[model samples]
Target: MILLKCFMVIFVGQFLDVTSVYNPMLTYNIRFNKLRFLPNVTGNYTIFQQKDKQYVSGYIQRPTTDEVNKYQLPVFHRCNPEGLNCEYFQSWTLTDLCTLLKDKNQIWSKWYGAFDPPILCPINQYTYVFRNSTGEVNIFLKWYPDVLNYQWKITQKLYSGDFYIGSYYNPMLTYVVRIVKITSYPNITWNYSVDTYKGKYYVNGNTSITTDKLIDKVVGVFERCAPEGINCEYFQSWTLTDICPKLLDKNQIWSSWYGRSFDPPVVCPINKIHYQIRNGTFDLDPIIKIYTDATNYYWKLTQKMYAGNTLVGSYKIETVFLGLSRIDDEGGVVSTDPSGLAYSPERSRL
Candidate 1:
């Protein structure tokens, strides 16, 4: 039996800027609320899969006296897009996470190349940051794999059982990692931030990208979801067959336009990395007739770079057709239900 875990409860297009589909990225957000505990907690997380990948990052202040063995475990909860109807998902001990860090990646000195903590779970007076610089992120951490084409959510319970933060308290730590979907006004360009290096993640700003390995393949996705990227219902996922190829896919939902309705993805995976691109921008202008039908919905377009099964980097553009409507693959058109936040398609109209 294939059991799934919990998810996020995003209020479609609430306060996020992202896009996706072929590059299945379940929009998410991180909420580190202040609570009565020995130490302060904060986190930065990413729940997206380029060639299918998930990542977690954040920091916990130096505790007065904390040990990994003193806590229960980090429990993850799942929920709906609107941040409702939650349930228990899974758990991971701080020690186990540490072991993976020490034994596997040997990243004790550099957790994601920016933050570092003692491999032995150093419990002295010191602040440290930890996150998956390289590895598999729990898919159900936000949404189930099967639901990639639909709107979804889940809950996460951050409790320090005297281990992570070294103070078992009543109100557990709540680490909310919300990956927001981009839905800017139609045709507005959005820049792609963040860069990933040798398992280390970086929100690349003016810095240059560290890797330019021969890109194997790239998945370009154009997905339609609610304003806040909820209940993503339509998916137009395609792939670049060579080092650099045009944006074309069998899921030509953009076929309506005589082929000139939207901007094409920039050819990528060149011999050299272009730092100049850090300031460049992209947007969604898919002129297909299907898009004309759903002018009321927000669309997210993403292009993910990969080397083998590894994700080298990615490009994202989030925006919505100012007046785009949504279409339901199952019902032809979205039902006029105010309570309905997304138009979930039974299947991708691929």
Candidate 2:
């Protein structure tokens, strides 16, 4: 029994010696959302393996390239002049390889080709590569329920012996991991519609006026909201118009307004009276008041902009005489400003 026990111990010792190799020391620098423009994005990561389970831990940090390079491991480049790409492989010690292979669901796996056997190189599902001003850096990232986690490991391999019996020896390097929560911007869209009107009115005793004009006007309020129906920014501006058409001989120019929020509203008159009123001339267009209230996700167009409200500007129309007839009972040329502010009965002025 003692001799048998001795033989078993010797066999086990030989097996362990052949399986275990020295692992090198490497450095790893990891970060999350490094390409984002937001502020206060600083995080770090640490990984620990206990039997079949892996534990990851870290804090956030916004480190610069120089700062991250402090933890970077040195790499020996063996570039092929003909090939424009560089390939990287993880160097693992015999002990680390045995430990990693023990986990059937290891995060890293080997690559396989169509006619070739699986290569000894390692790759992870969450691993990625990005290039900055300096060079390329390997990144391992994964999206959790509400946050993003990042990680990467660096190692070096040393080859010894013949191609058949010789083995690639790897030394342990640096491993980094980090978690961060990313804040996203909201998606927004704005729409609007306009309605036109026309009418006729008496200018000065038997001098009939027709409204068929076009006035460039913008009359509306601004609204904004978030995706989850929270945290919204809303505001409204003044609505200015040249003049109003008479009640009779009026037609609604609806279903014709279509434009983005930044575009000005197009006001087309329905009749000559409406057109003449707005086209004649005006000093200051009348301003309308606007009001808005906070709600879930809807914005209601309340009142128009009036005095004491946010006054953006006034709408004005230049004098445009289309050779239309103007008859006055007073035998004098008749002209009226669209703002209804002034009227002149002078032949020369008309």
Best by TM-score: 1
Question: What is the model-wide C-alpha lDDT for candidate 2?
Answer: 0.21
TM-score of each model, paired residue for residue: 0.27, 0.16
Model 1, position 154: C-alpha lDDT score: 21
How many pairs of residues collide in each model?
Answer: 48, 33
After superposition, the stretches of candidate 1 with alpha carbons farther than 4 Å from their true spots are: 1-59, 70-73, 93-98, 103-114, 118-125, 129-350
Q: Model 1, range 34-63, lDDT digits (tens) per residue?
A: 222222333333433233333335454543
Give all candidate RMSDs, comma-separated: 21.3, 30.5
Which candidate comes out best when scored by lDDT?
Answer: 1
lDDT of 2 by residue, 273-322 (tens): 21111212111101100100111122222222122333323321111111
Clashes of 1: 48
